[model samples]
Target: MKPQKKKYIFHPKVIKNYRGNPDLLRIHLTPEYTKVDFGYVAKDIYINGGWIRIAPETFIENKITKQRYTLVNAENIPIAPMHHYFETKKDWRYFSLIFPPIPQNDCLLNIIEVKNGTPNDFNYYNIELKMADGIELF
Candidate 1:
């Protein structure tokens, strides 16, 4: 049997040069999955008009290895063509995405919702995943 890898959790996280203003809330790296939690607060839109969704094909790519980790599942969010709308300007919607485990050695990734070159796309580039002294969960 192969040696098991330890699990890690990073809470209250931040990323470099994040675009489109979606908040990255947490990240859990486990033997089986790389889970990312996200949050978006309603802003600059009419009440109940702000909306968000994740494309079924959304993915995370390891920057150095050029390896793509495709999205496997999501929670508390809708797959695109569908959307989760905000009830008010102060409302915050939280969701999570699960992908195949990225090698712990890989420290940078791009979370791409799409590559259409629009500012509205939720594409976060060069997100630094510093595992150094990360809080081990298990």
Candidate 2:
């Protein structure tokens, strides 16, 4: 029999405070890779409508061990220097980033996307890896 791979899924409840205001949807931890999903709603065209990109320097840091997992790949999102422009004020985008598997014991984490002290930085802090009610693992 094939060995079963261990997998963990987390739906973060922590609020994201940033200019882009991307909503973190889910976090998937597997033996091979850690995947993070995010949703970006296009609203307030005059204020926040524009383009968004995932910087190459983006990472997921374990709050306790301080171990950092650098981004390995991205889906439905463009890497930095390349922008994903909004077609309309109502246009929204869902994207995911993949990184090396996070250690199972590191329950708390932070997702940082280029920390430059700017208003448009997409940084989420203190993300607890726990399953939220109604989020089923498939």
Candidate 3:
């Protein structure tokens, strides 16, 4: 069996963009860029900081740059499952939210936390993403 990756508290942070670089959230992609894998989390959110315990309509976008990052449900899982993405390992709930390729590489990921039925009831949190030059990821 392969070595198991240690499970730690999942704190959602942009480790890097498509390009293989640290402290930068820039993406270097070709025209065929459909989706980009953010170095935030591969799977299994432990209902902690990165992953919210309560399922809220969350989306990442930069209000300053006015760019909206689309949330793509890559996994065809049920909408009502407590375990949203990875297998139920912890007692807390988990889920995944795949985002399409960011339009601009040098942009901050603004997480827009929204409430059910109440659009006014929402919060915005910036994930301190890199706003430097994007690295080519084609």
What is the TM-score of each predicted model, taking all chains together?
0.85, 0.85, 0.39
Which pairs of residues have clashing backbones in candidate 2? none
lDDT of each: 0.79, 0.80, 0.37
Q: Over the stretch 45-112, how does candidate 2's per-residue lDDT look in tens digits?
A: 55456777899889999888888999999999999889888877778899999999876553788899
What is the lDDT, from 0 to 100, of the residue 24 in candidate 1? 81
lDDT for 56 (candidate 3) = 30
> lDDT of model 1 at residue 125?
77
- Candidate 1 stretches with Cα past 4 Å from truth are 1-4, 11-20, 47-49
lDDT of 1: 0.79
User: Distance from true position, residue 72, model 3, in Å?
Assistant: 2.0
Rank by lDDT, highest first.
Answer: 2, 1, 3
Displacement of residue 114 (Cα, Å) in model 2 is 1.6
- Would you list the rank order by TM-score, best first? 1, 2, 3
Give the least accurate 10-residue stretch of model 3, judged by summed lDDT. Answer: 19-28
* Candidate with the greatest TM-score versus the true structure: 1
Give residue 124's error in model 2 in angstroms: 0.5
Output the TM-score of candidate 3.
0.39
lDDT of 2: 0.80
Models, CA RMSD each: 2.5, 3.4, 12.5
**Which stretches of model 3 miss by more than 4 angstroms?**
1-57, 74-94, 113-124, 131-138
Whichever of 2 and 3 has more lDDT, that candidate is: 2
Residues 58-90 of candidate 1 have per-residue lDDT tens digits of 998988888998889999999888888887777
